[model samples]
Target: ENEVVASMSANVFKVQVAVGDKVIAGQSLIVLEAMKMEIPIESPRDAEVAEILTQKGATVSTGDVLVRLK
Candidate 1:
């Protein structure tokens, strides 16, 4: 299992993957807006998305778990 985490404090701008979705390494899973910049949180490895812990427009802090994969 793998957990994709937020790298910085930001608002979730978009969620690009859903539960059970297949994802590859480097695929964008979520978009976050912080300090007027958009950051794409990507998959670290190929896997099926198991859960999404955040929602669009939600505020998240650094190291927050965003997605879980299996």
Candidate 2:
């Protein structure tokens, strides 16, 4: 199976994609906030969202997995 995993170099602010949602390449999946600036995480492939590993306003690191696709 193919998957789209997302992570950031800062705190994650929100997850925009849900499970079972169809996503395209370069589509936004999560938003990360760092130093008061918002960063958006995008999908790498055209697939369906399989899991959400981060919550809204959750503190995350560079290696954190924000979303998974299948």
Top model number, TM-score? 1
lDDT tens string, model 2, 1-70?
Answer: 3543444567778878889999998899998888899888888889999888888867877766778788
TM-score list, all predictions: 0.97, 0.85
- Estimate, for each residue in 1-70, the C-alpha lDDT of model 1 and write its tens digit: 4999999999999999999999999999999999899999999999999999999999999999999999
Q: Using lDDT as the measure, which candidate wins?
A: 1
Q: Which residue pairs in candidate 2 collide?
A: none
Model 2, residue 14: C-alpha shift (Å)? 1.9
The C-alpha lDDT values of all candidates are: 0.97, 0.79
Clashes of each: 0, 0
Off by over 4 Å in 2: 1-7
